[model samples]
Target chain A: MPPRPNQCSQLSGDDYAESGRRAPAVQIDDVVVEKGRVRILDGISFTIPAGSITGLLGPSGSGKTTLMRTIVGVQAVRSGTVNVLGRTAGSAALRSSVGYVTQAPSVYGDLTVRENANYFATVLGRGRAEAERAIADVNLTHEADRLVGRMSGGQRSRASLACALLAKPELLVLDEPTVGQDPVLRRELWSQFRALADAGTTVLVSSHVMDEAARCDRLLLVRDGALLAEGTPAALCAAARTNDFEDVFLRLIDAADQKAAA
Target chain B: MLLVVPSSLLTLVYSMFHNQPGRFDHIGLTLLAVFPFLTMFLITSVSMLRERTSGTLERLFTLPIGKLDLIVGYATAFSGAAILQAGIAGLVAYQLLGLDTAGSPALVVIIALSTAILGVACGLLCSAFARTEFQAVQFLPVVVLPQLLLCGLFVPIDGMATWLGHVADVLPLTHAVSALDAVGSSSDPTAAMWQDLGIVLAFAVGALAAGAATLRRRAA
Candidate 1:
């Protein structure tokens, strides 16, 4: 059985030295990433607290994906530092500790869902029980024996998610995971993310949808390769003087544009 | 099927065109050099490119596996097909076609296997430059066709212009064809045959190193 929400924190705290304050799960200090001549992420800095669900909210082409990639240690940066799980991002030591799910489904099409999960689990030094539990966690038990190629688009994405979940990674980076999912499934997945956070996992999920912003414990609002705002959902909404989160987000972007114009 | 069918058809056509009693040796040598090389190159390139375009390669890189492990895994997996292909094509060209060669038949099979493995190495290097399967296929003209035209399977390098002969000397398939020719016409493998084999193996290793250097965790 999985540990309860409160017990999970103590479990993780024992592994690292918690002198007086716990270190953040992720720390980025003025990270700048460039692709060719275009700056994909411009001087971004933020710290993601351990065991929390942090939403990376931004418009399309606003560098949300690039930020996630940097955290996962896959995206090359032109400058700055990205520390994940107390180590440098993309270090060999973090390979098994970090789980990343891309926008597109990333499982082998020729393999059955179970086989895909098992293969990744074994790569991470986990066993079959973990693979099966991960399959069940994603609610893909029914499709376990089916080839990923024959599954529906949503099913395939969930299969990819299951593979990532196999190792119970300390840091999970998901890029637009709920894009095409149905309302009920999205709610369930969001709850799952919450449950994982409660169980001492740091989940950094990126989404363009404003409605999902409320579900995150903390939100990082990004626009034009720069961070526009970072705070709790209620604080941001109150600061923008709007109850509707979408309106608050638009107002922030408008404010940023006007500031730049001035 | 990839090697046997094309080689049998080519041998049949060549024999029909020549209509000579001792022409099977020429047919056998051509089949040994061209069939395995072409098939492995086309198949490996497209399949490996599909892994890139489908995003599997990106996920695989995130795993604990190293880049060299992935490249060698691909090479080893395809080499199984290459082995079977060389064996079948060699048997069909030698026994079924009644091709008579002065050299040891085992030497011809060895050349065919080397050429197939070489094809796999070159395919992997070329796959790094292609984004889609169609782009992988486009490399056929720029990469494989020139080697076919200059490899001395259809025309002797000696009969070509000096510059063209020089160009042929640089291609892996040219060395492969020369080795096949040397083994087909002599009782023992010549020094030139050994040198050409060494050159073909060098090309395979060099391309593999380049492929490893060029592999990216994600498509740019």
Candidate 2:
């Protein structure tokens, strides 16, 4: 039960854990989030390595959003801890360094995209120029003048992302950032995630889309408020004896179901 | 709300009793008694509910922003609106409709601002308990109605049931009405008027503190 980033179920046991690698961006140990009568995250444990794109993939309502919130330090934990950036999760110190994009568009609906980003930028002690750059980074420059409420679902979410990115956080937690986007935009978002990771920003994104799983450097396969598996895409597919992510996902679900039954 | 409520009270109600010797004075006092306390509370609570539902509060909390930061931010924004509203209401009553008060109209406007702040604080606190806008609106009855009913605008506390009189003494709106009444009939506010102002402001501060205490990291 000690904090082990590399010992998760079906881990690829890859060389990413070698010497001189940075410490984990996040370490969640037996984190249990109970809201009223229902347990939203049941003893979910995992580690996300620094500067890597880790996808948290699962079906809808499988606690992906809850787990992401847990890392962002907003979701109250019943029993266990989530340590991010070497301090307690949600610590005031982490605020400047961690970027969070909620599943809902958290920006003001009445404000233009630029104004929305500028508000967050000002919160972080930055300015409008930074907001413009963040907007451009999310490829929302064309829609920067549009009111967030009037924008399409995809644009609104991107505006949310642009605002989060204004902090230039070392760790980015996004919940389904590409959910309503077209295929081309989705591809662009994946590459943007890739680029952010390459620049040493640890990216943790949650999505139900399995194809998106293939683009992550690592994947935390979650279901039923618990982690079913965590490993590289190839390792996950190989362990299930199938190359297709959807097939392996169903296989893992069945295996977990059997384990629960036993 | 600030302009329309007082303007209508001046035009419609004062018109009906314009022939009465002292009716304009009662109208002026009555407008200051309950208008700000009611509308500001409703508007502030509903807007706070929007912040909760939109999930922006979570994002704001996650920042290095302290609870006081949010509380004060909301307080200042709504308080600014309240003061502006009071200014307009005061101007419309004194300059346009000739709803006369013995005290400086400035003092009346100040009392309205105090009651408006109390409303905002109450709204902020109630919004913490509400999950939806409808629930927030429902609180108007539970939170605002008792104060309105017992504030003695309809009947003096001396004529009310003994327990109801005690309850009115404890309500913030009662203090607001008493303060505005002192301003209505006298050029120099009585000692009791100062005490009433203190009570209204103290209640506003207490409610805001309670609201700040209710803010939590739990998912809304």
Give the candidate number with the greatest lDDT. Answer: 2
Error of 2 at B85 (Å): 0.8
Question: DockQ of all candidates, in order?
Answer: 0.51, 0.58
- The parts of candidate 2 lying over 4 Å away from their true place are A1-20, A260-262, B1-5
- Once model 1 is optimally superposed onto the true structure by TM-score, how far is the C-alpha of residue A153 displaced, in angstroms? 1.8
Measure candidate 2: CA RMSD: 4.9
Kindly report which residue stretches of model 1 are placed more than 4 angstroms away from their true locations once superposed: A1-21, B1-18, B217-220
Q: What share of the true interface contacts does each candidate keep?
A: 0.42, 0.66
Q: Compute the interface RMSD for each candidate structure.
A: 2.0, 1.7
Looking at model 1, residue A210 earns an lDDT score of: 74
What TM-score does chain A reach in every model?
0.91, 0.91
Tell me the deviation in Å of residue B58 in model 2: 0.6
lDDT of 2 by residue, A1-262 (tens): 5632222233443534441199998999998887778888889889999988888988888899889888988887899989998999988899989999999989999899998898888888998889999999889998898899999888989999898988888999999999899989989888988788878899999887877777777889988798999888778877788767778789999988898899
lDDT of 1 by residue, B1-220 (tens): 6746765676675568566766657755766777777888898899888777777777777778789888888888787888877777777777777777778888887888888888888888899899888899998889899999999867889999999999999999999888888887899889999999999988988988998888866433
- As a whole number from 0 to 100, the lDDT of residue A29 in candidate 2 is 95
